[model samples]
Target: MLILHRRVQLLQMTLVDCTREKFSKYEQLLNDAGQKPEFWDVVVITARDDSQKSIFDYQISLKKQRHEVPSFVKYIVISDPPGVKVGSGGSTLHCLEYLANNFGQHSLSQWKVLIIHAGGFSQRFPSQSVLGKVFLTLPCSKYPIQMLEALLMMYISIPGKMNYGVFIAASDVIFLFNEKGNWDFRVPGFVAIAHPASLKLAKNHGVFILEDMISPWGKYRSDPSSPAMVATPKCFLHKQTAEVLKHKDSYLPTVPI
Candidate 1:
């Protein structure tokens, strides 16, 4: 058991937000994170809205600037429309599913993936002087990191005790890799849920779930403030949740940490 435990490795992932039409700017985040030829392969997950051809073009341009081919960079395009397009959490979930199915394959299960949302910043173009202010200005609870945690915990079940983590930041956020900060995959569990102080300020500290008051997949009722507005597990965890738990009596509840 001890030998097997020692052999166990978690997945280190970085789920860059590529929902935007332009991806050229996203490379800077990777560069700042100390991306190098020695670094492991990076999978750039894109939504259905993103075209592989366009992404390749962006990568080519970036490579010219960097003066080297980003051999470590890989792209995985998701068929689901991103939250900005169709439904909330749809795009992020698709990315998670991609990791779970593909990374969970044989031999690969031993690795830990660290997910970093390149688009976690509030603004794409932030000045150097205001970078510090931007980092401190964003609310932790509202930070996309919360959504990342809730989504991963609610979904993605690993076979072994293998764990996962995310590196979230608001604009002006910088991730430095050194003696203290390394790409090593740690144990499975909540490594860190962003700045802990932010949780204390949340108005509703509990999980925010969608309630489906209307039944039989019908249209909205005349009254807008129906039970569907607040009663969840009864409504659905997500649109995808509605598909599986359509038994009318079935309830799919999600627990957020």
Candidate 2:
């Protein structure tokens, strides 16, 4: 377990170094546009009912350290009702309802929400089962930081990319991207980040088949600062076999949002 954790930290550090320049530029762009780069009005973390106390304890720890958490961001933990087995999708809906009830309908349209689904037991990683996966300690930095803090840092630049809307993500995955290109986040509906992956890896994940066979990274070579491509998915295949993926020309596996 220690070796696995160290490997994760090394990977995370390498990716952060690779993307540092681009992320800095992106944040500067946001600042130039008169926006607070990493500010999320509300961050809602979903947890199992039994994990509520520990999650709150984590929040309190953050408060004790004055500089740990952002002042503009509000953290809310919505625990699943006891004995209720609401899955991720259901928990998301409950979170939305909770927001509407507490913050009121009018305020909903004004605030940018980041909903993190961290409710499940970490069966595969039994070491984290007690504290929940999101609260798992990370060894990337000198100051102690948990998986939740690292996840927030990974997505810090995203709030400035779009208008008022919810950014939903799972607790386990960390996406690293070079933000050199412009991303059109003002699209009408839902937008997701898709990462290139091998067919073997895509087999157990959601795969996006594009309408055209055009390369999304084609412009990156010619113009590294070109706007990133966003396309309406031609089709979506969930947990499909490699044979099925081959037929669909699947190359990019979407990061589960």
Best by TM-score: 2
Q: What is the C-alpha lDDT of each candidate?
A: 0.32, 0.70
The C-alpha stretches of model 1 lying farther than 4 A from their native spots are 1-38, 45-48, 51-57, 68-70, 75-90, 100-104, 107-185, 196-257
lDDT of 1 by residue, 58-114 (tens): 544554465332344443334444355543244455556666687764313433333
Runs in model 2 deviating more than 4 A are: 1-15, 18-38, 50-54, 57-66, 217-228, 251-257
Question: Taking the tens digit of each residue's C-alpha lDDT, what string does model 2 give over 1-257?
Answer: 68656655665665667456444553353345454554689988888884564665576466436455554567888887677688988888889999999989876678889998888888899887666778777776646767776677777767778778888998888777644456756676778888556777889999888776455544333333333566667888999988888778765334211
Query: What TM-score, computed on C-alpha atoms, does each candidate reach?
Result: 0.33, 0.78
Q: What is the lDDT of residue 170 in candidate 1?
A: 25
Candidate 1 yields a Cα-based lDDT of: 0.32
How close to the true structure is residue 36 of candidate 1, measured as C-alpha lDDT? Answer: 43
